[model samples]
Target: MVKKQNIPAKEKIVSVVLLAGLILFMAIVIGPGFSEPSSPNQNVAEQMLPAGWSAVGGWEIYPKGRLYEKINGREPLFDQYGVVRLRYASVSKGTNDFEVYFYDMQTPDGALGIYLANTPSEFDELELGTLADISGGQVRVLKGRTYLEIFSLAEQTPKDFLIDLSSALVETIPTEKEARRTAVELLPKQGRVRGTLILNRENTYGLAKLTDIFSASYQQDNDEFDYMIRTISPSEGRKMIAAVGEEIFEFDGEIIQSETNSLVAEFMGKTLILNQTGDFLIGLYGAVPPDQGRRRLDQWIETMKDQLHGSGK
Candidate 1:
Protein backbone atom coordinates (compact mmCIF):
# COMPACT_ATOMS: atom_id res chain seq x y z
CA MET A 1 0.00 0.00 0.00
CA VAL A 2 1.28 3.44 -0.93
CA LYS A 3 1.54 6.13 1.77
CA LYS A 4 -1.22 8.79 1.56
CA GLN A 5 -0.24 12.44 1.31
CA ASN A 6 -2.16 14.81 3.56
CA ILE A 7 -3.33 18.22 2.44
CA PRO A 8 -1.79 21.25 4.23
CA ALA A 9 -3.91 22.54 7.13
CA LYS A 10 -3.96 26.13 5.74
CA GLU A 11 -4.84 24.89 2.22
CA LYS A 12 -7.68 22.78 3.61
CA ILE A 13 -9.11 25.76 5.49
CA VAL A 14 -8.97 27.90 2.35
CA SER A 15 -10.73 25.21 0.32
CA VAL A 16 -13.48 24.91 2.91
CA VAL A 17 -14.04 28.67 2.93
CA LEU A 18 -14.20 28.78 -0.90
CA LEU A 19 -16.66 25.91 -1.01
CA ALA A 20 -18.95 27.62 1.51
CA GLY A 21 -18.87 30.84 -0.52
CA LEU A 22 -19.74 28.95 -3.68
CA ILE A 23 -22.73 27.32 -1.97
CA LEU A 24 -23.98 30.71 -0.74
CA PHE A 25 -23.64 32.22 -4.23
CA MET A 26 -25.55 29.39 -5.84
CA ALA A 27 -28.24 29.59 -3.18
CA ILE A 28 -28.71 33.28 -3.83
CA VAL A 29 -28.92 32.78 -7.58
CA ILE A 30 -31.31 29.81 -7.70
CA GLY A 31 -33.01 29.53 -4.32
CA PRO A 32 -36.80 29.23 -4.09
CA GLY A 33 -39.26 31.78 -2.60
CA PHE A 34 -38.16 34.71 -4.80
CA SER A 35 -40.79 34.26 -7.50
CA GLU A 36 -42.86 37.15 -8.82
CA PRO A 37 -46.56 37.36 -8.01
CA SER A 38 -49.07 36.06 -10.51
CA SER A 39 -51.08 38.54 -12.53
CA PRO A 40 -54.52 39.35 -11.20
CA ASN A 41 -57.61 37.79 -12.86
CA GLN A 42 -59.96 40.72 -12.33
CA ASN A 43 -61.21 42.75 -15.30
CA VAL A 44 -61.49 46.54 -14.98
CA ALA A 45 -62.48 47.13 -18.62
CA GLU A 46 -65.48 49.37 -17.88
CA GLN A 47 -64.17 50.90 -14.65
CA MET A 48 -62.96 54.36 -15.67
CA LEU A 49 -64.10 54.63 -19.26
CA PRO A 50 -65.66 57.92 -20.33
CA ALA A 51 -69.44 57.84 -20.74
CA GLY A 52 -70.07 60.61 -23.26
CA TRP A 53 -69.40 58.45 -26.33
CA SER A 54 -72.36 56.10 -26.99
CA ALA A 55 -71.33 52.44 -26.77
CA VAL A 56 -71.98 50.67 -30.02
CA GLY A 57 -71.70 47.42 -28.05
CA GLY A 58 -70.61 46.12 -24.66
CA TRP A 59 -66.91 45.83 -23.71
CA GLU A 60 -65.09 42.48 -23.84
CA ILE A 61 -62.45 41.60 -21.28
CA TYR A 62 -59.80 38.97 -21.93
CA PRO A 63 -58.20 37.82 -18.69
CA LYS A 64 -54.70 36.37 -18.61
CA GLY A 65 -55.96 32.83 -19.23
CA ARG A 66 -58.14 33.80 -22.21
CA LEU A 67 -55.78 36.31 -23.87
CA TYR A 68 -54.22 33.61 -26.04
CA GLU A 69 -57.63 32.31 -27.11
CA LYS A 70 -58.85 35.82 -27.88
CA ILE A 71 -55.86 37.21 -29.79
CA ASN A 72 -55.02 33.95 -31.61
CA GLY A 73 -51.93 34.48 -33.80
CA ARG A 74 -50.62 37.54 -31.91
CA GLU A 75 -50.74 35.84 -28.52
CA PRO A 76 -47.02 35.13 -28.50
CA LEU A 77 -46.19 38.83 -28.90
CA PHE A 78 -48.55 39.80 -26.07
CA ASP A 79 -47.05 37.07 -23.89
CA GLN A 80 -43.58 38.35 -24.65
CA TYR A 81 -44.63 41.77 -23.31
CA GLY A 82 -45.92 40.19 -20.10
CA VAL A 83 -49.52 41.00 -20.81
CA VAL A 84 -51.86 40.59 -17.86
CA ARG A 85 -55.22 41.56 -19.36
CA LEU A 86 -56.83 43.11 -22.43
CA ARG A 87 -60.09 45.05 -23.03
CA TYR A 88 -61.81 45.77 -26.28
CA ALA A 89 -64.71 48.05 -27.25
CA SER A 90 -66.48 49.13 -30.38
CA VAL A 91 -68.21 52.51 -30.47
CA SER A 92 -69.64 54.91 -33.00
CA LYS A 93 -69.68 58.72 -33.03
CA GLY A 94 -71.98 59.94 -35.85
CA THR A 95 -70.63 58.36 -39.05
CA ASN A 96 -67.24 57.39 -37.53
CA ASP A 97 -66.68 53.99 -35.90
CA PHE A 98 -63.82 53.33 -33.48
CA GLU A 99 -62.28 50.13 -32.09
CA VAL A 100 -60.62 50.76 -28.73
CA TYR A 101 -58.21 48.24 -27.24
CA PHE A 102 -56.66 48.61 -23.81
CA TYR A 103 -53.74 46.37 -22.76
CA ASP A 104 -52.77 45.84 -19.16
CA MET A 105 -49.09 45.03 -19.12
CA GLN A 106 -47.13 44.02 -16.05
CA THR A 107 -45.03 47.18 -15.91
CA PRO A 108 -44.41 50.50 -17.58
CA ASP A 109 -41.41 49.11 -19.44
CA GLY A 110 -43.47 46.21 -20.70
CA ALA A 111 -46.18 48.55 -21.98
CA LEU A 112 -43.54 50.69 -23.67
CA GLY A 113 -42.09 47.64 -25.37
CA ILE A 114 -45.50 46.67 -26.73
CA TYR A 115 -46.20 50.22 -27.84
CA LEU A 116 -42.92 50.36 -29.78
CA ALA A 117 -43.64 47.02 -31.38
CA ASN A 118 -47.13 47.96 -32.57
CA THR A 119 -46.86 51.61 -33.67
CA PRO A 120 -46.06 52.64 -37.23
CA SER A 121 -43.48 55.10 -38.56
CA GLU A 122 -45.86 57.98 -39.19
CA PHE A 123 -47.03 58.24 -35.60
CA ASP A 124 -46.44 61.68 -34.10
CA GLU A 125 -45.35 62.09 -30.50
CA LEU A 126 -48.09 63.43 -28.25
CA GLU A 127 -47.69 65.12 -24.86
CA LEU A 128 -49.72 62.77 -22.68
CA GLY A 129 -48.72 60.67 -19.69
CA THR A 130 -45.30 58.99 -19.81
CA LEU A 131 -45.29 58.78 -23.63
CA ALA A 132 -47.93 58.90 -26.35
CA ASP A 133 -47.66 58.43 -30.12
CA ILE A 134 -50.50 59.28 -32.44
CA SER A 135 -51.02 58.76 -36.15
CA GLY A 136 -53.75 60.04 -38.42
CA GLY A 137 -56.16 57.23 -37.52
CA GLN A 138 -54.57 55.50 -34.52
CA VAL A 139 -53.43 56.56 -31.06
CA ARG A 140 -51.13 54.60 -28.75
CA VAL A 141 -50.06 55.58 -25.24
CA LEU A 142 -47.86 54.03 -22.56
CA LYS A 143 -48.79 54.88 -19.02
CA GLY A 144 -47.95 53.24 -15.69
CA ARG A 145 -49.21 49.67 -16.26
CA THR A 146 -51.19 49.91 -19.49
CA TYR A 147 -50.91 50.51 -23.20
CA LEU A 148 -53.88 52.06 -25.01
CA GLU A 149 -54.45 51.45 -28.72
CA ILE A 150 -57.33 53.40 -30.30
CA PHE A 151 -58.03 52.66 -33.94
CA SER A 152 -60.38 54.81 -36.03
CA LEU A 153 -62.38 52.64 -38.42
CA ALA A 154 -63.60 55.47 -40.62
CA GLU A 155 -61.20 57.75 -42.49
CA GLN A 156 -63.37 60.71 -41.55
CA THR A 157 -62.73 60.30 -37.79
CA PRO A 158 -61.18 63.62 -36.77
CA LYS A 159 -57.71 63.62 -35.18
CA ASP A 160 -59.15 65.84 -32.43
CA PHE A 161 -61.47 63.02 -31.38
CA LEU A 162 -58.51 60.64 -31.06
CA ILE A 163 -56.54 63.17 -29.02
CA ASP A 164 -59.52 63.86 -26.72
CA LEU A 165 -60.11 60.15 -26.07
CA SER A 166 -56.40 59.52 -25.44
CA SER A 167 -56.23 62.48 -23.08
CA ALA A 168 -59.29 61.33 -21.15
CA LEU A 169 -57.94 57.81 -20.74
CA VAL A 170 -54.47 59.00 -19.72
CA GLU A 171 -55.97 61.24 -17.06
CA THR A 172 -57.71 58.23 -15.51
CA ILE A 173 -54.73 55.87 -15.43
CA PRO A 174 -51.98 56.07 -12.80
CA THR A 175 -48.69 57.51 -13.95
CA GLU A 176 -45.19 56.64 -12.85
CA LYS A 177 -43.97 58.59 -9.80
CA GLU A 178 -40.69 59.41 -11.45
CA ALA A 179 -39.72 58.94 -15.09
CA ARG A 180 -36.66 56.75 -15.51
CA ARG A 181 -34.38 57.77 -18.34
CA THR A 182 -33.47 54.68 -20.33
CA ALA A 183 -29.99 53.59 -21.45
CA VAL A 184 -31.04 54.28 -25.05
CA GLU A 185 -31.06 57.99 -24.26
CA LEU A 186 -27.29 57.82 -23.71
CA LEU A 187 -26.55 56.74 -27.29
CA PRO A 188 -24.56 59.34 -29.24
CA LYS A 189 -26.86 61.24 -31.61
CA GLN A 190 -24.18 62.19 -34.14
CA GLY A 191 -24.24 59.14 -36.37
CA ARG A 192 -27.40 57.55 -35.02
CA VAL A 193 -30.40 56.99 -37.29
CA ARG A 194 -33.66 58.51 -36.20
CA GLY A 195 -36.53 56.16 -35.31
CA THR A 196 -34.12 53.19 -35.34
CA LEU A 197 -34.05 52.44 -31.60
CA ILE A 198 -35.79 49.17 -30.76
CA LEU A 199 -36.50 47.87 -27.27
CA ASN A 200 -36.57 44.06 -27.44
CA ARG A 201 -38.48 42.46 -24.60
CA GLU A 202 -37.58 38.93 -25.77
CA ASN A 203 -35.24 37.07 -28.11
CA THR A 204 -32.99 40.06 -28.75
CA TYR A 205 -30.82 39.44 -31.81
CA GLY A 206 -31.82 35.75 -31.60
CA LEU A 207 -30.00 35.46 -28.24
CA ALA A 208 -32.63 33.84 -26.06
CA LYS A 209 -30.51 34.27 -22.94
CA LEU A 210 -30.48 38.03 -23.46
CA THR A 211 -33.78 39.85 -22.93
CA ASP A 212 -34.83 43.46 -22.37
CA ILE A 213 -32.02 44.61 -24.64
CA PHE A 214 -32.12 47.91 -26.58
CA SER A 215 -30.60 48.10 -30.06
CA ALA A 216 -30.09 51.01 -32.44
CA SER A 217 -28.74 51.56 -35.92
CA TYR A 218 -25.68 53.74 -36.49
CA GLN A 219 -23.86 54.98 -39.55
CA GLN A 220 -20.16 55.59 -39.86
CA ASP A 221 -18.50 56.35 -43.23
CA ASN A 222 -21.79 55.30 -44.88
CA ASP A 223 -21.41 51.85 -43.22
CA GLU A 224 -24.42 50.86 -41.16
CA PHE A 225 -24.21 48.69 -38.04
CA ASP A 226 -26.15 48.01 -34.86
CA TYR A 227 -25.21 48.27 -31.18
CA MET A 228 -27.02 46.99 -28.13
CA ILE A 229 -27.01 47.50 -24.36
CA ARG A 230 -28.78 46.12 -21.31
CA THR A 231 -28.57 47.17 -17.70
CA ILE A 232 -28.42 44.37 -15.14
CA SER A 233 -27.03 43.76 -11.68
CA PRO A 234 -23.24 43.72 -11.53
CA SER A 235 -23.22 40.06 -10.53
CA GLU A 236 -25.49 39.11 -13.41
CA GLY A 237 -23.45 41.26 -15.77
CA ARG A 238 -20.25 39.43 -14.89
CA LYS A 239 -21.98 36.07 -15.31
CA MET A 240 -23.29 37.12 -18.73
CA ILE A 241 -19.81 38.20 -19.78
CA ALA A 242 -18.46 34.81 -18.80
CA ALA A 243 -21.21 33.02 -20.77
CA VAL A 244 -20.60 35.17 -23.84
CA GLY A 245 -16.89 34.50 -23.60
CA GLU A 246 -17.53 30.79 -23.92
CA GLU A 247 -19.83 31.31 -26.91
CA ILE A 248 -17.30 33.41 -28.81
CA PHE A 249 -14.52 30.92 -28.09
CA GLU A 250 -16.63 28.10 -29.45
CA PHE A 251 -17.20 30.12 -32.64
CA ASP A 252 -13.38 30.44 -33.11
CA GLY A 253 -13.47 34.14 -32.36
CA GLU A 254 -10.22 35.89 -31.42
CA ILE A 255 -10.07 37.94 -28.26
CA ILE A 256 -8.43 41.20 -29.25
CA GLN A 257 -8.61 42.77 -25.83
CA SER A 258 -9.19 41.16 -22.46
CA GLU A 259 -9.12 42.98 -19.18
CA THR A 260 -10.48 42.68 -15.69
CA ASN A 261 -13.66 44.63 -16.52
CA SER A 262 -13.84 44.58 -20.33
CA LEU A 263 -13.55 42.16 -23.28
CA VAL A 264 -13.32 42.64 -27.05
CA ALA A 265 -13.62 39.84 -29.56
CA GLU A 266 -13.48 39.67 -33.33
CA PHE A 267 -15.64 37.04 -34.98
CA MET A 268 -17.71 36.20 -38.06
CA GLY A 269 -16.27 38.96 -40.25
CA LYS A 270 -17.02 41.62 -37.67
CA THR A 271 -15.89 43.02 -34.35
CA LEU A 272 -17.88 42.69 -31.11
CA ILE A 273 -17.10 44.28 -27.77
CA LEU A 274 -18.55 43.76 -24.29
CA ASN A 275 -17.97 45.84 -21.19
CA GLN A 276 -19.43 46.01 -17.69
CA THR A 277 -19.49 49.13 -15.57
CA GLY A 278 -21.69 49.69 -12.53
CA ASP A 279 -24.51 47.23 -13.30
CA PHE A 280 -24.54 47.81 -17.06
CA LEU A 281 -23.46 45.49 -19.85
CA ILE A 282 -22.82 47.60 -22.95
CA GLY A 283 -21.88 46.13 -26.28
CA LEU A 284 -21.09 47.11 -29.87
CA TYR A 285 -22.01 44.54 -32.49
CA GLY A 286 -21.23 44.20 -36.21
CA ALA A 287 -18.54 46.86 -36.29
CA VAL A 288 -15.82 46.55 -38.87
CA PRO A 289 -12.14 47.43 -38.42
CA PRO A 290 -11.67 46.71 -34.72
CA ASP A 291 -10.27 50.19 -34.09
CA GLN A 292 -13.46 51.96 -35.23
CA GLY A 293 -15.57 49.70 -33.07
CA ARG A 294 -13.34 50.32 -30.06
CA ARG A 295 -13.48 54.07 -30.62
CA ARG A 296 -17.27 54.02 -30.87
CA LEU A 297 -17.55 51.95 -27.72
CA ASP A 298 -15.18 54.29 -25.86
CA GLN A 299 -17.23 57.27 -26.93
CA TRP A 300 -20.44 55.61 -25.83
CA ILE A 301 -18.93 54.65 -22.47
CA GLU A 302 -17.75 58.18 -21.84
CA THR A 303 -21.11 59.70 -22.70
CA MET A 304 -23.11 57.17 -20.70
CA LYS A 305 -20.84 57.46 -17.69
CA ASP A 306 -21.14 61.23 -17.71
CA GLN A 307 -24.89 61.21 -18.20
CA LEU A 308 -25.61 58.53 -15.62
CA HIS A 309 -23.25 60.01 -13.03
CA GLY A 310 -24.55 63.52 -13.53
CA SER A 311 -28.12 62.34 -13.08
CA GLY A 312 -27.16 60.55 -9.82
CA LYS A 313 -28.55 57.29 -11.20
Candidate 2:
Protein backbone atom coordinates (compact mmCIF):
# COMPACT_ATOMS: atom_id res chain seq x y z
CA MET A 1 0.00 0.00 0.00
CA VAL A 2 1.31 3.56 -0.79
CA LYS A 3 0.14 6.99 0.39
CA LYS A 4 -1.70 9.04 -2.35
CA GLN A 5 -0.35 12.59 -3.00
CA ASN A 6 -1.85 15.79 -4.69
CA ILE A 7 -0.55 16.42 -8.27
CA PRO A 8 2.18 19.10 -8.62
CA ALA A 9 1.17 22.50 -10.23
CA LYS A 10 3.85 22.06 -12.96
CA GLU A 11 2.40 18.65 -13.99
CA LYS A 12 -1.15 20.09 -14.11
CA ILE A 13 0.04 22.86 -16.45
CA VAL A 14 1.71 20.44 -18.92
CA SER A 15 -1.37 18.17 -19.05
CA VAL A 16 -3.74 21.15 -19.73
CA VAL A 17 -1.48 22.40 -22.59
CA LEU A 18 -1.41 18.96 -24.24
CA LEU A 19 -5.21 18.63 -24.11
CA ALA A 20 -5.65 22.12 -25.68
CA GLY A 21 -3.36 21.24 -28.61
CA LEU A 22 -5.28 18.07 -29.37
CA ILE A 23 -8.62 19.96 -29.49
CA LEU A 24 -7.14 22.63 -31.83
CA PHE A 25 -5.86 19.98 -34.23
CA MET A 26 -9.23 18.25 -34.42
CA ALA A 27 -11.07 21.53 -35.19
CA ILE A 28 -8.71 22.44 -38.01
CA VAL A 29 -9.06 19.03 -39.63
CA ILE A 30 -12.85 18.69 -39.47
CA GLY A 31 -14.42 22.17 -39.61
CA PRO A 32 -16.13 23.67 -42.71
CA GLY A 33 -14.64 26.62 -44.66
CA PHE A 34 -16.10 30.10 -45.00
CA SER A 35 -17.15 31.86 -48.25
CA GLU A 36 -18.16 35.38 -49.43
CA PRO A 37 -21.71 36.41 -50.34
CA SER A 38 -22.89 37.02 -53.94
CA SER A 39 -24.18 40.34 -55.23
CA PRO A 40 -27.92 41.15 -55.35
CA ASN A 41 -28.10 41.96 -59.08
CA GLN A 42 -26.26 38.83 -60.03
CA ASN A 43 -28.57 36.80 -57.89
CA VAL A 44 -31.63 38.42 -59.48
CA ALA A 45 -30.38 37.91 -63.03
CA GLU A 46 -29.69 34.29 -62.35
CA GLN A 47 -33.29 33.96 -61.32
CA MET A 48 -34.74 35.89 -64.27
CA LEU A 49 -33.59 35.42 -67.87
CA PRO A 50 -33.33 31.89 -69.22
CA ALA A 51 -30.17 30.04 -68.45
CA GLY A 52 -27.22 31.40 -70.49
CA TRP A 53 -29.04 34.66 -71.35
CA SER A 54 -26.77 36.69 -69.16
CA ALA A 55 -26.44 40.44 -69.10
CA VAL A 56 -23.71 41.57 -71.44
CA GLY A 57 -21.40 44.47 -70.71
CA GLY A 58 -22.80 47.98 -70.19
CA TRP A 59 -25.97 46.72 -68.59
CA GLU A 60 -27.39 48.41 -65.48
CA ILE A 61 -30.21 47.80 -63.05
CA TYR A 62 -32.53 50.75 -62.51
CA PRO A 63 -33.86 51.90 -59.15
CA LYS A 64 -37.19 50.38 -60.03
CA GLY A 65 -35.40 47.04 -60.32
CA ARG A 66 -35.67 46.86 -64.11
CA LEU A 67 -32.56 46.05 -66.14
CA TYR A 68 -31.64 48.25 -69.10
CA GLU A 69 -29.19 47.63 -71.89
CA LYS A 70 -27.86 50.22 -74.29
CA ILE A 71 -27.95 49.92 -78.05
CA ASN A 72 -25.18 51.52 -80.15
CA GLY A 73 -24.60 53.96 -77.27
CA ARG A 74 -27.79 55.91 -77.84
CA GLU A 75 -30.77 54.41 -76.05
CA PRO A 76 -31.38 52.48 -72.82
CA LEU A 77 -33.87 49.69 -73.36
CA PHE A 78 -35.52 46.65 -71.79
CA ASP A 79 -36.43 43.32 -73.33
CA GLN A 80 -39.84 41.68 -73.03
CA TYR A 81 -40.82 38.47 -74.81
CA GLY A 82 -37.78 38.85 -77.06
CA VAL A 83 -39.02 42.27 -78.12
CA VAL A 84 -36.85 45.26 -77.27
CA ARG A 85 -38.80 48.42 -76.55
CA LEU A 86 -37.15 51.78 -75.89
CA ARG A 87 -38.85 54.77 -74.30
CA TYR A 88 -37.56 58.22 -75.17
CA ALA A 89 -37.75 61.32 -73.04
CA SER A 90 -39.65 64.36 -74.33
CA VAL A 91 -36.45 66.35 -74.72
CA SER A 92 -34.90 63.97 -77.25
CA LYS A 93 -34.53 65.41 -80.79
CA GLY A 94 -35.10 64.35 -84.39
CA THR A 95 -36.29 60.89 -85.49
CA ASN A 96 -34.34 59.86 -82.41
CA ASP A 97 -37.75 60.23 -80.83
CA PHE A 98 -39.29 56.71 -81.08
CA GLU A 99 -39.84 53.33 -79.52
CA VAL A 100 -38.41 50.24 -81.28
CA TYR A 101 -39.21 46.51 -81.13
CA PHE A 102 -37.26 43.38 -82.11
CA TYR A 103 -38.82 39.93 -82.49
CA ASP A 104 -39.19 36.77 -84.64
CA MET A 105 -42.03 35.65 -86.92
CA GLN A 106 -43.08 32.39 -88.51
CA THR A 107 -42.34 32.14 -92.24
CA PRO A 108 -42.63 29.46 -94.88
CA ASP A 109 -39.03 28.47 -94.41
CA GLY A 110 -39.18 28.95 -90.68
CA ALA A 111 -39.29 32.23 -88.70
CA LEU A 112 -38.81 35.64 -90.33
CA GLY A 113 -38.14 38.30 -87.79
CA ILE A 114 -36.52 41.75 -87.44
CA TYR A 115 -36.61 45.32 -86.16
CA LEU A 116 -39.45 47.41 -87.60
CA ALA A 117 -40.91 50.93 -87.68
CA ASN A 118 -44.08 50.60 -85.55
CA THR A 119 -45.23 54.15 -86.23
CA PRO A 120 -48.15 55.33 -88.32
CA SER A 121 -46.72 54.28 -91.68
CA GLU A 122 -48.47 52.75 -94.67
CA PHE A 123 -46.17 49.77 -94.21
CA ASP A 124 -47.54 48.95 -90.78
CA GLU A 125 -49.87 46.37 -92.34
CA LEU A 126 -46.80 44.38 -93.27
CA GLU A 127 -45.69 44.14 -89.66
CA LEU A 128 -45.66 40.68 -88.06
CA GLY A 129 -46.38 41.62 -84.43
CA THR A 130 -48.67 44.00 -82.59
CA LEU A 131 -47.97 47.64 -83.52
CA ALA A 132 -46.45 49.41 -80.48
CA ASP A 133 -45.04 52.53 -82.16
CA ILE A 134 -47.20 55.08 -80.37
CA SER A 135 -44.60 57.81 -80.08
CA GLY A 136 -43.03 59.42 -83.13
CA GLY A 137 -39.73 57.78 -82.30
CA GLN A 138 -41.10 54.27 -81.69
CA VAL A 139 -40.41 51.28 -83.99
CA ARG A 140 -42.18 47.92 -84.19
CA VAL A 141 -40.90 44.55 -85.35
CA LEU A 142 -42.26 44.44 -88.84
CA LYS A 143 -41.47 42.16 -91.78
CA GLY A 144 -37.66 42.22 -91.93
CA ARG A 145 -34.56 42.46 -89.80
CA THR A 146 -34.24 46.20 -89.35
CA TYR A 147 -30.97 46.94 -87.65
CA LEU A 148 -31.73 50.57 -87.11
CA GLU A 149 -34.62 52.90 -87.95
CA ILE A 150 -35.20 56.44 -86.56
CA PHE A 151 -38.45 58.40 -86.44
CA SER A 152 -39.17 62.14 -86.18
CA LEU A 153 -42.30 64.22 -85.68
CA ALA A 154 -40.38 67.31 -86.80
CA GLU A 155 -40.17 66.26 -90.44
CA GLN A 156 -42.50 68.03 -92.86
CA THR A 157 -42.32 65.14 -95.31
CA PRO A 158 -42.05 61.39 -94.91
CA LYS A 159 -38.71 61.53 -96.70
CA ASP A 160 -36.63 61.04 -93.57
CA PHE A 161 -38.82 58.16 -92.42
CA LEU A 162 -38.77 56.60 -95.85
CA ILE A 163 -35.01 56.89 -96.20
CA ASP A 164 -34.35 55.32 -92.81
CA LEU A 165 -37.05 52.71 -93.26
CA SER A 166 -35.95 51.80 -96.76
CA SER A 167 -32.36 51.55 -95.70
CA ALA A 168 -33.23 49.30 -92.74
CA LEU A 169 -35.59 47.18 -94.85
CA VAL A 170 -33.05 46.75 -97.62
CA GLU A 171 -30.24 45.87 -95.26
CA THR A 172 -31.86 43.04 -93.25
CA ILE A 173 -34.44 41.51 -95.59
CA PRO A 174 -33.52 39.55 -98.70
CA THR A 175 -34.40 41.03 -102.05
CA GLU A 176 -35.81 39.28 -105.12
CA LYS A 177 -33.12 39.09 -107.79
CA GLU A 178 -35.81 39.49 -110.43
CA ALA A 179 -37.22 42.57 -108.73
CA ARG A 180 -33.74 44.07 -108.46
CA ARG A 181 -33.12 43.30 -112.12
CA THR A 182 -36.28 45.15 -113.04
CA ALA A 183 -35.29 48.06 -110.83
CA VAL A 184 -31.80 48.11 -112.40
CA GLU A 185 -33.30 48.44 -115.86
CA LEU A 186 -34.91 51.71 -114.79
CA LEU A 187 -31.63 53.39 -113.71
CA PRO A 188 -29.61 55.73 -115.98
CA LYS A 189 -26.34 54.02 -116.89
CA GLN A 190 -23.20 55.75 -115.70
CA GLY A 191 -19.77 55.11 -114.13
CA ARG A 192 -19.62 52.19 -111.72
CA VAL A 193 -22.32 53.19 -109.20
CA ARG A 194 -21.61 51.05 -106.18
CA GLY A 195 -23.70 50.50 -103.01
CA THR A 196 -23.29 47.95 -100.27
CA LEU A 197 -25.65 46.48 -97.65
CA ILE A 198 -24.42 44.75 -94.47
CA LEU A 199 -26.39 42.83 -91.81
CA ASN A 200 -25.31 41.47 -88.41
CA ARG A 201 -27.11 39.24 -85.92
CA GLU A 202 -27.25 42.11 -83.48
CA ASN A 203 -30.12 43.39 -85.65
CA THR A 204 -28.10 46.08 -87.36
CA TYR A 205 -27.25 47.02 -90.96
CA GLY A 206 -24.90 49.33 -92.80
CA LEU A 207 -25.65 50.80 -96.24
CA ALA A 208 -22.92 52.76 -97.92
CA LYS A 209 -21.87 54.13 -101.28
CA LEU A 210 -18.43 52.69 -102.05
CA THR A 211 -16.29 55.31 -103.74
CA ASP A 212 -12.70 55.14 -102.47
CA ILE A 213 -11.82 51.46 -102.77
CA PHE A 214 -8.30 50.54 -101.72
CA SER A 215 -6.34 47.76 -100.06
CA ALA A 216 -4.41 47.90 -96.83
CA SER A 217 -2.65 45.47 -94.51
CA TYR A 218 -5.42 44.17 -92.19
CA GLN A 219 -5.41 41.66 -89.31
CA GLN A 220 -2.05 39.87 -89.01
CA ASP A 221 -0.64 41.37 -92.29
CA ASN A 222 -3.31 40.16 -94.73
CA ASP A 223 -4.20 42.57 -97.58
CA GLU A 224 -7.89 43.44 -98.04
CA PHE A 225 -10.20 46.09 -99.48
CA ASP A 226 -11.08 49.06 -97.22
CA TYR A 227 -14.47 50.69 -97.68
CA MET A 228 -16.88 52.98 -95.81
CA ILE A 229 -20.53 52.89 -94.69
CA ARG A 230 -22.93 55.45 -93.25
CA THR A 231 -23.41 53.41 -90.06
CA ILE A 232 -22.49 50.05 -88.54
CA SER A 233 -22.94 48.23 -85.28
CA PRO A 234 -20.94 50.23 -82.76
CA SER A 235 -19.92 47.07 -80.98
CA GLU A 236 -18.82 45.43 -84.24
CA GLY A 237 -15.48 47.21 -84.17
CA ARG A 238 -14.05 44.55 -81.84
CA LYS A 239 -15.74 41.47 -83.28
CA MET A 240 -13.85 38.80 -85.22
CA ILE A 241 -13.61 38.94 -89.04
CA ALA A 242 -15.24 36.02 -90.79
CA ALA A 243 -14.81 35.46 -94.54
CA VAL A 244 -11.92 37.26 -96.22
CA GLY A 245 -12.22 36.26 -99.90
CA GLU A 246 -14.89 37.67 -102.18
CA GLU A 247 -18.03 35.54 -102.70
CA ILE A 248 -18.48 35.90 -106.47
CA PHE A 249 -14.87 36.85 -107.23
CA GLU A 250 -11.42 36.23 -105.83
CA PHE A 251 -11.05 39.85 -104.73
CA ASP A 252 -9.66 40.14 -101.23
CA GLY A 253 -11.70 41.58 -98.37
CA GLU A 254 -11.61 41.42 -94.57
CA ILE A 255 -14.55 41.00 -92.22
CA ILE A 256 -14.75 42.50 -88.72
CA GLN A 257 -11.27 42.65 -87.21
CA SER A 258 -12.27 42.69 -83.56
CA GLU A 259 -13.85 40.18 -81.13
CA THR A 260 -17.43 40.01 -82.39
CA ASN A 261 -20.15 37.38 -82.30
CA SER A 262 -21.68 39.14 -85.32
CA LEU A 263 -21.30 38.57 -89.09
CA VAL A 264 -20.05 40.90 -91.85
CA ALA A 265 -20.01 40.93 -95.66
CA GLU A 266 -18.95 43.32 -98.42
CA PHE A 267 -19.45 43.45 -102.17
CA MET A 268 -17.52 45.45 -104.76
CA GLY A 269 -18.56 45.58 -108.41
CA LYS A 270 -20.84 42.52 -108.28
CA THR A 271 -18.39 40.85 -105.93
CA LEU A 272 -19.89 39.50 -102.71
CA ILE A 273 -18.29 39.81 -99.30
CA LEU A 274 -19.53 37.27 -96.75
CA ASN A 275 -18.48 37.06 -93.10
CA GLN A 276 -20.25 35.13 -90.39
CA THR A 277 -19.87 34.50 -86.65
CA GLY A 278 -22.30 32.36 -84.72
CA ASP A 279 -25.75 32.43 -86.39
CA PHE A 280 -25.52 35.97 -87.81
CA LEU A 281 -24.87 36.50 -91.55
CA ILE A 282 -23.05 39.46 -93.08
CA GLY A 283 -23.42 40.15 -96.80
CA LEU A 284 -21.92 42.75 -99.13
CA TYR A 285 -23.13 43.57 -102.63
CA GLY A 286 -21.22 45.70 -105.09
CA ALA A 287 -21.92 47.37 -108.44
CA VAL A 288 -24.72 45.72 -110.40
CA PRO A 289 -27.59 47.10 -112.49
CA PRO A 290 -29.87 49.11 -110.15
CA ASP A 291 -32.93 46.84 -110.33
CA GLN A 292 -30.77 43.78 -110.43
CA GLY A 293 -28.74 44.90 -107.45
CA ARG A 294 -31.81 45.68 -105.40
CA ARG A 295 -33.44 42.38 -106.31
CA ARG A 296 -30.33 40.40 -105.62
CA LEU A 297 -29.75 42.13 -102.29
CA ASP A 298 -33.36 41.52 -101.32
CA GLN A 299 -33.18 37.89 -102.30
CA TRP A 300 -29.96 37.45 -100.40
CA ILE A 301 -31.42 39.15 -97.38
CA GLU A 302 -34.45 36.85 -97.59
CA THR A 303 -32.16 33.88 -97.61
CA MET A 304 -30.21 35.24 -94.65
CA LYS A 305 -33.41 35.99 -92.78
CA ASP A 306 -34.49 32.42 -93.29
CA GLN A 307 -31.15 31.23 -92.01
CA LEU A 308 -31.39 33.41 -88.91
CA HIS A 309 -34.92 32.24 -88.20
CA GLY A 310 -34.10 28.60 -88.60
CA SER A 311 -30.94 28.82 -86.55
CA GLY A 312 -32.51 31.14 -83.94
CA LYS A 313 -29.46 33.37 -83.86
For candidate 1, which ten residues in a row score worst on lDDT? Answer: 33-42
Q: Provide TM-scores for the models.
A: 0.67, 0.19
lDDT, residue 77, model 2: 22
RMSD of every candidate to native, in Å, equals 18.7, 20.4
Model 1: what TM-score? Answer: 0.67
Give candidate 1's error at residue 26 in angstroms: 52
Q: Could you tell me how far off, in angstroms, the CA of residue 263 lies in candidate 2 after the best superposition?
A: 46
lDDT at residue 120 of model 1 (Cα atoms): 90
Poorest 10 consecutive residues of model 2 by lDDT? 211-220
The clash count for each model shown is 0, 32
